[model samples]
Target: MASPARSLNPTPPLKGSFPLDHFGECKAFRIDYLKCLKERDGAQYECRDVAQRYLQCRMDAGLMEKEEMSKLGYTKSNSNRRRVSQDSYKKSKESKGFIAGLSK
Candidate 1:
C-alpha cells in the first residue's frame, strides 16, 4: 500500500532587524542572536523572542546587565504567558480554574 501524502504547506523564515545600538556593548548580543537563529528546513523561527530569551539568560548569568539589555530594547516580556499557555485558554474561560488537582 502507498503511504499517505504529507501537506505541501511550507513554513516561512523569520527575520529580525538590526540591533537597537550599532556600536554599543549590546551589539555582541546581536551577533549571538544571529548565530543561534533558529533555522530548519530552510525556514527560520521568530528571532526576536528567542533572542530576547537568550539575552535574559545572559543577564541572569551576570554577563550582561539589565540596563544594557534595556538599552538594546530587551526588557521583560510584554505578553501574558497565561493566555497562551495552552490551547484550552483559547477555547473557553472555564479553563481558568480548571486544573488537575493533587490527590490525598
Candidate 2:
C-alpha cells in the first residue's frame, strides 16, 4: 500500500509573531529573571522587576515588538506605587485580619 502525501501549513501566532533569539541575545536577562523567580520561591509578583527587564531586553534585541513600558504595566510611578501597596498590604494583614487584608 502507498502512504498518503503529507503537507504542513503554518500560521502566524494569534497575537502576532516574534523573532526567536537563536543567538542568545537576551539570555542574560532571561537568566536573571529565572534566578529571581527561584529566589522568590516562584512568587512571580515579587519578580516583576526582573520580568520587565527581560521583556525590555527582548524588545531591545528586536526579538519582540516594541511597546510602551506603561502598556506593559511598568512605569516610573509604578515602582513607587508597588512599594506603597506592599507596605499597605503588610499593615492591613497586621491590623485588619487576613480576610480584611485581602480587601485592601
Candidate 3:
C-alpha cells in the first residue's frame, strides 16, 4: 500500500483562513471596527482606520501573519505626522492660505 502523502509546506492559508480567537485576544478591536461600520451605515471605506486597527490587533495576537500596512493598501496614519500648533496655524493663515501651507 502507498503511504499517505504529506504537504511539503505546512503553512496555513495566507488569506480567508485564520484560527478562531477563542481567548478574545482581539475582541475589543473587532467590536470597535464593527461599531464604526454600523455608525457609517456599512460604508466600509469610511471605517478603514478602525478596520486597520482590528487587523493590527489580529496580527499582534498571532491570529494572522504580520504584514506591511502599505502593502496591505493602508496609508500612513495621521498620528505619525508632526502636530501643528495653534501658532503655526495662525501664521500660516496670516501668510499663505491654510490649505496652501498644509504641505509645508
Candidate with the greatest TM-score versus the true structure = 2
Q: Model 2, which residues run further than 4 Å from truth?
A: 1-15, 83-104
Residue 26, model 2: lDDT of: 92
Q: Across residues 9-36, which tens digit of lDDT does each residue of candidate 1 receive?
A: 9655443322344335455665666666
The candidate scoring highest on lDDT is 2
TM-score of predicted model 3? 0.58
Q: List the global CA lDDT of all models.
A: 0.52, 0.83, 0.77
lDDT of 2 by residue, 8-62 (tens): 8987796578777899999998898899989877867678888898899998888
Evaluated against the true structure, the overall lDDT of model 1 is 0.52
Clashes of 1: 0
Point out the worst 10-residue segment of candidate 2 by lDDT: 95-104
User: Candidates sorted by TM-score, descending order?
Assistant: 2, 3, 1
Q: Could you tell which candidate, 1 or 3, scores higher by lDDT?
A: 3
In the range 1-87, model 3's lDDT, one tens digit per residue, is: 999998796776657578899999999988998999898778566677888998999999889889988778787554233123434
